[model samples]
Target: MTQTVGSRALSSPRELTRVADRSSFIYLERCIVHRDANAITAEDAEGTTHIPAATIGTLLLGPGTRITHQAMSVLGECGAAVAWVGENAVRYYAGGRALTRSSALAEAQAVAWANQRTRLDVARAMYRLRFPDEDPSGLTRRGLLGREGDRVKDCYRKNSERTGVRWRKRQYVPGDFTAGDTVNQAITAAAQCMYGITHAVVAALGCSPALGFVHSGHELSFVLDVADLYKTEIGIPLAFDIAAESDEDPGPRTRRALRDRIHQLGLLDRCVTDIKSLLLPSGTQASEITVADSDIDRVSLQSDHDQLLPSGTNYGDEAGW
Candidate 1:
């Protein structure tokens, strides 16, 4: 006797049905497809036609490119972010998921609250570092002494202008906008690149991407937090310099340089100790291990093994079991 896996017939050819898979995937630089009518279609390298927009998780359109409304709609329906390359490489669209009401509210609240707190904290820290000999009360009474935002904007503007790029006023509003020139495009590209990288880092650490002390929410919380910390301090300045220096269009090379600058600025080295830590066994003793740069690699390894072992299982337990 033959056994059946489900309620349906196993041997009947006429009863067979094809199930559609709507999972999303990403399109890399080389996976883009172009049309004879000055349009482009993107898919995997296997030459599959009519790449379902739903299958696309994210679409990165390189510099000097365009997409049709139909394609954009498909991507939107499928919940994908369309990142374009240009002077201010911008996110043209953030798909359906980005526009959800709950997500929007959460994101807005997170950003606003985080921004306020971050501004205060950053100001205090900068004040202490800049004027150690000065009285703290005097600095507090001075009322908004540091001009970090202005410094960032001015540095960015100068660098952009040097590269023949001009940007409109900094619009903190979320979503996509066109870059006025190559310089503006470069700055936007660098910023988004940092955002993506930071999001990935937060995901790898098993932390909610949306839900930040400086950035709050159910979507991109941690990414927003990390971006808040770096954008004004590092990203803005780097974008300015990159815009000013590179004569030709800055592509992958520019991205690499930007990432290198982030590292040079020690962005990742900064400690975020707000997250709770788990106690780990060390011989007969247990110690609390917080997530930090030094412990990131070790924690990542342990996280991988967490599925096979219980939540509280220690590193040494693996050897016995």
Candidate 2:
């Protein structure tokens, strides 16, 4: 990390840009990424690009990217997610960063997930968000799955017709991208980008990505659920458009398109709002999500009757003794 004098001090959590207002994600490869004060400098054979760390929601470190510890520290402090991915950004090996140290949202998510009935309720809420015109209430998990499958098929049909792309059933092997046609390849690329973005938001919110309402059993089940919220609205349509334009370099093209669309649509802000609405209780104030100057680095110990006690104090000489 670069040390600075008077006015150029390190930024506190309160000073960092809100996750919703930041850039969706940046994909970089074959570079050395290091911190330069509040910005991260990416050095390559061509040149060095300085990116404001506070403005980035996610950093997708692709193959051949070597990031320094200082860069990682600054990203973590700025609440930016750092993901290690394979070439062409196809494989997601790991990603994490908690923008907020507070556990309120995480606890709320756990409470909702711990019960069967509430879990179903949250799942219904998620489906409702995705398909606002339809009523997913009282629908069982299997019914929801069936409904989702039908909706996705309908979406594919609609996009194919609108884009004049040949419509076939969605097909692609898990690890094999070449097995799919041009459209499928584009869709896969778009979906991967969506996952990366959603995963970053999930981590930034300090919520467990494994605890999903509709999707389950996988580590990124919740991420999948959130990403699907905009599949029809963003991913599917964009993928079709890419396929219609050209069959070459579908991955990179799709990624660039997705990033631009995300920014233009202000999807990051909407995503943050939707996740909070899904995990937090009804009518929860938006102020609860904001980080205040005093809240930064504040730690407290849980006590009896839901009270919190300040740390670094000796309670042994108190009434109990």
Candidate 2 residue-wise lDDT, 1-321, digit = tens: 443322356666665637788889899999999988888989999998888888887788877999999988878778787778765536555665687767788889999999999999999998899899999988999999999899989999999999999988798788787788888988998898888889888988888999999888999999999999999889999999999999998888998999999989999889989998988888888578554445556678888899999988888888964
**lDDT at 269, model 2:** 89
Off by over 4 Å in 1: 1-28, 31-151, 154-168, 171-178, 246-253, 263-287, 290-321
- The Cα error of candidate 1 at residue 287, in Å, is 6.9
Clashing pairs in 2: none
Looking at model 1, residue 91 earns an lDDT score of 39
- Per-model C-alpha RMSD: 14.9, 3.1
List TM-scores for all candidates, in order. Answer: 0.42, 0.91
Q: What is the TM-score (0 to 1) of candidate 2?
A: 0.91
How many clashing pairs in candidate 2?
0
Report the CA-based lDDT of candidate 2 relative to the real structure. 0.85
Best by TM-score: 2
| lDDT at position 118, candidate 2 | 92
